[model samples]
Target chain A: MTLIQFLAIGLTILILLKTISDFKKNRINLLAFLFWTGLWSSVIIVAALPQITMPLAKISGLERGIDVVVYFAIVFIFFLLFKIIAKLEKIEYEITQIVRKNALQKQNNRPQKKI
Target chain B: MTKLIVIIPAYNEAKTIGNVIQGVKKYTDNIIVIDDGSKDNTYQTALQSGAKVYRHQINRGLGGALGTGIEAALLNDGDIIVTLDADGQHNPNEIPNLIKPIIKGKADIVIGSRFLKNQSMPFFRRLGNYFFNLMTFIFFGIYTTDSQSGMRAFNKKVAQNLKIYTNKMEVSSEIIKQVRANQFRLKETHIKAIYTPYSLAKGQGFFVGLKTLGKLLILKLTQ
Candidate 1:
């Protein structure tokens, strides 16, 4: 195989292994694992056949496979950014609620001095 | 969460919190004071006044304090929850008038609107109230005479379901949105407010209103 094929194949296999390990460790659920598996499989297919993306790139008005990959990466990063921000906000709300509940419980258990 | 529990969110209102709690006691014995990290003796004074005082480690603003107060009330089996300001701007005597609709099964939420008809309020402040009410109408599709009123009554279910995340003056608007989103009954009553020098001085200014509006708009977009 060519050097580029060897490198791409190595990286795809590494990522696929990591994804399976993450799923086994219960860090990622079945849906996320499937997503990563499908994504890396597509990457592996594209790497094995470098000429396969030409039609996709031309159909999407892009000049080259590299441009198509760059555009898709940018869109994927933005989607991940939105998801992370939303998850962060949810965590913040939960923290505030938990803190409030704990404070109230502590106050109720403690006896107060009556005037 | 069965009896009426009045939840008061106080922040740096040591001067008026004592009297406000005392006035509320005259109406009901189940009084809860959430001291939002006051720098003064607000917690001690509230404790001395015979109201259960929950102290936050740091100031969480009005919404944070109210969130704590409501959580406490719900946990203690509060059948009804009444919220009022600690600056003594709201009259504790009017708690009954506010809760009457809820007790009669006519409404699940009651708002003590100072603008059912303009009371003794400054022109700019009245304008501010109108603007907030209009915004609530546009955003939440729930119109009221005053959406910014601090004195409000909520049923136990409403208290438990209404999730408040804002930590400042924006909470007032957020409450209206929740009321609409949950399809709860909302009623407004004409309640008098004593806008004294102290209250006016400590109350939200025009810029604070703008900031609240911005926060609410962002909250809407995100949701």
Candidate 2:
């Protein structure tokens, strides 16, 4: 096996172990745990047997097996980034609502000044 | 007599907030200053100026502050609500003109347009306003001479129906969008802008304007 393949396999195994640990600690839900496990396991398979991606590359009209993986990785990363942005926006909106409610409640409790 | 409540959303405007409150006091006794987590003494100054003050513990930007101010005004039984900048750029004396349409049952929302009177504004600022006006029209299919005007008067019904979702300078555009969506009667009146070094130093810059446009686009997509 090539040095790159050895390193890729090792890194993916470490990531998969971490994902399992997170699932065990209830840090991620079953769906999330399954997603990460499937993703990393595929990465391990692709790294260990580069020939397995040949059919995927041919069907996707890519020149090489690695090209198929790279394209998928790029698209997946973009999807994750979009999800993160939407989640952050929702969190910000919620925070503003809480702050507004607190400010109004505090103001209401104060002595009413003749306006 | 309509109970007019003036809401001034201020952030670090201690220098001018007191004067702004006092100016608005000439028009209406119901003045509300939303100190959007100012690190200064804006709250105390507004209070000392005899205006009701509500303060956010952390800054939530212009939209958030306006939302709070509108809710507070509605709670206090305000018949009409006016929003003015705390930077003292908006003339409180002209506030009577702004609310006149609402009182006369003509307009549900009146925007104080600086462009209507041929007032002298910085060339770039005018150009920027035109650009944002076009953007507002493009995004929400609503056109206005001054989509970014800080001074606006709306009746209690409009205030209760309006929803401010953004928390930044883009709130100006969002307000225009909401007016279009709710099909409220809108009017524009000429009002002179008081330009001072301090006031000029506070509003949206070129980059902030671009950011506002970007946020407005996102708002359109998400909502």
Candidate 3:
């Protein structure tokens, strides 16, 4: 393979790996990883294989097929982040409810012994 | 597990503090009242009612008092803890029901809902609660009957894990948000609310609601 071809393949793999690692560490959903890898794989195929890139780019109204894949991946990642944030909020609501209840019960129970 | 305890956060609630303490003592003996620097004799009256009192040197707001109470409850070997407002809007008779889920190991947290079943609240307050309740459901997918309800119950795990920074009423929203982030089991129980004219007057008005939402937005942005 030429130097450019080799670089394209290596860069795609690197991006896919980095995205997966970030997702795992942050507890991002697995679907997000899949979407990213799909885009990365598209880049390798679009650059290394001219026949696929030329026809697809022309039909999709894009100068480069790889750009479309990257755009899709970015949008998908944002959707995933929103889902995780919503989940976190639900957990917080439950904890607060309990804490407030515990406080009230303590206040109520203080008077019986004194009486 | 150590015996369960209760924490009451009071701020200038001298009018109702004694009755609230008396009402709670009928159900349980483990109680702690944190006077949030009340300008009135809230602390003295609570003490007179026989509650273990922790006086905040200065007014810390509801959230600050709650944080102090939670810290004290943890240190005191409290296995379970319940929190209720000092304004006497929450019914102490519902304590057993709130604690049941924790005892059954089904939930780390339980919230008392005034909107559940037959309970009723004031018109404007109910409208405000419904609006926030819808927002919480839309934003977090947690279908609680009352998002603004001040009464709640927690196990030691939850009480120990809490870290609230909101000094005002938005701490209510913050608590639910934290529970969602931590991925703990949550449940809601039906409870009666006693919203007297005084409490209704003291409750959140339009400006207070705006302030709370703004504070929550700012906190969310900072985090």
The estimated TM-scores of all candidates read 0.73, 0.94, 0.65
The residue ranges of model 1 lying beyond 4 angstroms of the native Cα positions read A1-92, A113-115
Cα lDDT computed for each candidate against the true fold: 0.86, 0.91, 0.79
After TM-score superposition, what is the CA distance of residue B42 in candidate 2 from its true location, in Å? 0.4
Model 1 Cα lDDT, one tens digit per residue, B1-223: 1499999998888899999999998888898899888999998888888888888877778888899888888877899999999889999889999999999999999999898875779989989888988998888788888899899998988998988988778899999999989999999998999888999988879898898887677567678
Model 2 alpha-carbon drift over 4 Å, by segment: none
lDDT of 1 by residue, A1-115 (tens): 6998889989999999999999999999999999999999988988888788898788888788767876897999999887776676566667667768778767767866321
Best by lDDT: 2
Per-candidate interface C-alpha RMSD? 3.6, 1.2, 8.9
* Pairs in steric clash, model 2: none
Question: What are the chain A TM-scores for all the models, listed individually?
Answer: 0.84, 0.94, 0.50
TM-score of 2: 0.94
Model 2 C-alpha lDDT per residue in residues A1-89, reported as the tens digit of each score: 99999999999999999999999999999999988999999999999989988988889888888898989899999888877867777
**Regions of model 3 farther than 4 Å from truth:** A1-115, B138-141
lDDT of 1 at B208: 89
TM-score winner between candidates 2 and 3: 2
